[model samples]
Target: MFTSRTFKINKICEYLLNAKVKRCYPKHILSNRSVHDVIDVDINGVKLIFPNVWLRDNCQCEQCFHVTAKSRIIDYNNFNVDTKPVKVTKNSNSLQVTWDDGHKSKYGFNWLKLRSFSPKYQKKYNDDIYRSPKIVWHGKDFYEICKKHDYKDIVSSDEALHKWLNDTSVYGVSVIEKTPNSETAIDEIVKTVGFTKRTHYGEKFVVQNVTNTSNVAYLSSSLQIHTDLPYYEYCPGVNMLHFLVQTKGEGGENILSDGHYTAKYIKDNFPEDFKLLTNVQVEWSDVGEEAGNKFYKLYRAPIIEIDSNDEINRINFSIPQRGSHFPGSIEDVVPWYKALKLFFNLNKKFAAKFKTPEGNILVFDNIRLLHGRNKYEDSENNVRKLIGAYIDWDEIYSRLRCVKVKLNLID
Candidate 1:
């Protein structure tokens, strides 16, 4: 049934179809090419371009890379920046390279794709791996979504711990109910996340009216909503306040406002004021002696800090600790004051008033939330006592990532 001429025609047709299939790859996927300083790799239709120096430094050989340590053991001092790839071969799941120095290196397709020097990949990495997304909220609406976790569950279960940290990351606040009233109870809660951050007030501080008060918070007065430690260059990230004893008298209710929500409102309604708050640098200082140690801390920064991405990062506002000296020009004084007044008024309007029950731990992101309390009478019969501590964001987020990994929420 077959002839020589028919067989030759069939072979020609098959060869043509195979060639056409090879050319069918999408144009967006770059072909393998080496430039003067970089190599363009095409992995299953995804384009990944890598620099020559970077690829050489990231060689995956046992001699150049330590498998146990997951670090590069190559000598940087003897590294050749101009190293060239003498040969390159692509497999189904990896790329093989032979360097000019006869060094053989192989890289997994997924690994190279993750480290792609492309804007799209970079943004994907940031969104998926860098940090959790923040949810800006108003007090009135946030109150309904604010769920309290049991103290025992938070300390005992990883699921509860992840939920608390995740909520705090998104909403910037969380509450724990049924906490022990003992002095060391705060320590147990803090140890679950990280170590206690010590300040001039010691590892932890107490908020109660005293005979000789060093801090304004120790006085029996209505405090304005504000962030703590604006004077510190590296302010504490989170604040945990345990209501050990609540006052029987009227007042002493907590006031809370989301600084990010207020900032967004200002940016939308009063753009000029928002710009002033983010651009004008002011001095925040604290002076006096506490716990038999004298210290004066001062830091200069804008009230509203804007990150490189032009997003509100943190709010620094403390009326009691603000410096007397004005740093702006004379003409900028009234406008700055007006802007600050508007900000304070907006904060008050958006504030949530609540009375945290005794034996409850109210935790919040100090950098993102403004907090204060009403004046309460402190007598022998009724005394208001609160134990407070701080934990850095780095520690909290680190624990969160580890918990997520353990729970298989992320790879």
Candidate 2:
């Protein structure tokens, strides 16, 4: 009686550790469905039915998976779809499967529970709740928590690097201070994040007030808040601007607005306009000439992009880059402009203004943060110079995930 009671208590503790699975699948079991050619496992409340071939293919043994590299070595083509398990048995905390071809595979309960492809977990994933954690900020208070990291610490310490990456991921922006005021400093910063995502502008673009400007960014004019490369089919995901020289005078502040926050406010206040912007496709193009190089590109997409869960994923609002030709009927054109006007006004209202000093680097999500520059005069002495670059989210998130793994922030 004592031994049985102790075993029951241990099982209860284990279930408590896996509360999510235990709550969903209270009384779980491991069994084989020979007729279906699959293995069945009932996690506390969740039922997982995986194909036999999938089980064999995902085996993590030394022969199947490289322990060092943590990658699969199994030749998937060697396994047939009709593969079936000859026997299935449950050990203390694992399920053992013996294949018809005399292959054995072992999967811990926790691993199987996490890797389960059940409808419940699939629904959770589709719900968009498991995405990178985000902390939305609007107005002046946003500046209070703007995380800043030293350039040296970012390159040297994984902890500091992770903090910067995590802050950028969650807040859509971050500042890197004490950056070396050299042309190559941007490369080091970009390397920290991953790599530069080159565009038609080149691997790196220069941002400075010039006599005869090559692009709007080169001219001393107020740039309306917008995302870069809205004209590209696959717009660059991350943007970084390292200030080599801070401009003198009153009107050289960089404007940054949380596109996600602006869109959410519009959705809540102007539902009709929000719906129109989300549905209508607008043409964005950049046709220009620089150093005898002619460039013209166009792309059509809704100004506001929403995912399946009705959450804002992207905001493409570039007044200068927008093409003259608008899509849809004449009646829809007026509503589209109305929606654009409302959105633009909201962006201006909610934008945060700050002057980036020399040796400071600003990193933001091109997809979620709308950035612009204030008009400034180019005196011989107080000229502004900034080096700009881009990198995709794949690289940024890869680095973030790597750091998170090293820091044990995720399993």
Model 1 C-alpha lDDT per residue in residues 31-122, reported as the tens digit of each score:
23422355667677555557667889999899999999979999887899878888888778888888888988899987787677666666
Query: Over the stretch 275-336, how does candidate 2's per-residue lDDT look in tens digits?
Result: 89899999999988766779899999999999997978888989889999987668889888
Q: What clash pairs does model 2 have?
A: 24-45, 25-44, 25-45, 25-46, 26-44, 26-45, 197-390
Error of 1 at 158 (Å): 2.0
lDDT (C-alpha) at residue 148 in model 2: 85
- Using lDDT as the measure, the top candidate is 1
State each model's CA lDDT, in order. Answer: 0.83, 0.79
Off by over 4 Å in 2: 1-57, 61-86, 99-103, 117-131
Q: What lDDT does candidate 1 reach at residue 369?
A: 93
Task: After the best TM-score superposition of candidate 1, give how far the Cα of residue 398 lies from its true spot, in angstroms.
Answer: 1.4
TM-score of each candidate?
0.85, 0.82
Model 1 residue 191 distance off true place after TM-score fit, in angstroms: 1.3
lDDT of 2 at 368: 89
